[model samples]
Target: MPKILPLFAKALTDSWRSTLGWAVGLTAACMLYLPLYPSIGGSAQMQDLINALPPEMTKALNYDQIASGPGYTQATMFGLLGFLLMSMASIGWGAAAVAGDEESGLLELTLAHSVTRAQVVLERALAMVVRIAFLSVLVFLVVLGLNGPSQLGIDVGHLTGAVLLFAALALFSGTAALFAGALTGRKMYAVAAGAAVAVLGYVFNAVGRQSPDVEWLLNLSPYHWAYGNSPVANGADWGAVAGLFGISAAFIVLGSLALRQRDVGV
Candidate 1:
């Protein structure tokens, strides 16, 4: 007979509602935004209006290319709303994976079973990966479904690259929270860590766009690694994608080790 990962199953079962809510919310956001793109984006007057906005404002919002199909999709859907939704979902799951369970005394109970501490941590992380992957695929399908109607001329290859990069970026933030939670066993700490990574990465990328002296800062920002070159219009930056995934994998390994070495519910 084959063995099942009980902790992974439990994690999914316990958090299915939150996962469903995030999926539904992401779908709704994608549907609403993509449908509106044609009406607003297809208008020359609207392009002029966007062009008239302050350069700093456009750069900050990654809105410099809202006049075209791929650009519109990137600026509104992937760069703005989709980014916000995925980040929130990933961060919440990461925090809850370890720190929330520990805080609630559930970690202790789960560990009292036959499972090793490594299994608990790794399974929880795996569950998070699965949930994030599901949401990413949902985003890809929703966007692809609306591509023609919305006049988004993004090639399938570029679209796939954008989706993959976006998912990796979100996972990186989640793993930051996961690492913090495993190290500290505190939910608040995990939340703070994840939020810090997301917010700082975004700010650095935005600011770097405005100043050449600070442009190098973008190298340190995950937001830049994901969307710096406008993956929706361009294509995947394979190096950046690799960096994001590598960093995330490193965090998971460190977090798992930390969890194994520490006492639960302490």
Candidate 2:
């Protein structure tokens, strides 16, 4: 313990305000959507509205389960809206971790201290892990609080599974951004890479839902891997969670290598 990871504390301190903003946003999302379940998920008209939509549209959006409590919560917080929001936040943090600092010349200052390049990347990645884990816990608690009032019908076990899957999914994008940032030393590349994964993975999952012919896309889509077995209801496929964490670990390793190979670009 040689007082390593000076960057870890610095990163969290630097971004506390942004992290708080994310917290507010996440909690607000939980309150807004979960409360509406009693009105929307419980309504016959809501079902009518869903039925009125094209089957293809419904399938793509996972609207088939909007009437149920667990399904409603999944479609809202853990699946669609919150999913995109968390992914966006993850990408922002991940991009800023290395590429943003490099561009700002702050990385040079950090490097002037006694630290290896891998340590810089590792500390930043650890910061990301902490933040995402916090948000995931935030989601778990907020959703749990709403479960009784909003009638979400989420059990502790299944809810835990949902949040775990959601965390892994968001981290998947974040690590992609980290890898891209380290590889190119450009924040734009990091954002693009992360966005590509979120958007394309979502599309692949949607398409795979359309028919069995393309269902193989489900296997490759991170979105599907998280939600494919209906984690909210089925209590998560542990194998998928392990796969996501494994892949994220690989990205971190690759990012360290990439950063080490290149000039700091400061």
Candidate 3:
């Protein structure tokens, strides 16, 4: 068997286990709220809820009326943004896949074989891609299943867009793990940094929504572009999707280069 496959397989296994709860939580939350969507938080109901919500609560939730339609409401207002809370799951996965092995000195052992440093890094990144792809598939299915009745409801494009967006985020966080592995040589730090980036991005996105003047700051946060469901609610933003993939690619490439340049077990 190929060496990378084992690494990739292990990563996929671990990532699946790690994100299982998040997927469940996402599905459960959407399922639970979906029943209440009509009177509890659809277009007309959401309008009243928004009016009643305090400014701070509204700001935290990114409450926007455009995200109030049946299909879009659950995805945009609830499902799509769940990654903000679940990102730590990816972060933990990234950290364990990379720095955890390194910390155990398995990285040096693996490199002692036929694998080169670049191969190690590439395989690790590939593992992340596979892992995140699994998460994306789960999320898409769960969201689609929960909103199954939205025939003219849930926008397929919007749903696919949101999945791609989160995949990009997972890639971005996974890349940061490489940097954390190289710099700190510690899994904990790598995990924490990835989690922080994901969480902070959501916080910034919230801030941007609440205050238009500082909205420019939203550009810096991944959450700003993660709202593919937003475009579905109103009009999807092709630019946001492009920007997300573009930025995520940059981070992954830069992190790979950095990993290659560094000496392992340093």
Candidate 2 Cα misplacement greater than 4 A, ranges: 1-4
* lDDT of the structure predicted as candidate 1: 0.90
lDDT by residue for model 2 over 1-266, one digit each (tens)?
A: 76556789988889899889998999989888999999998799999999999988888888787888898888777888889889999999999999988988888877788888998899999999999999999999999999899877888999998899899999999999999999989999999999988988899988999998999998889999999877886789999999998899899889999999988874
Clash total of candidate 1: 0
Task: Give the Cα lDDT of each candidate.
Answer: 0.90, 0.89, 0.63
User: What TM-score does model 2 achieve against the real structure?
Assistant: 0.97
RMSD of 3: 3.2
- Cα RMSDs of all predictions? 1.2, 1.3, 3.2
- TM-score, structure 1 vs. true: 0.97
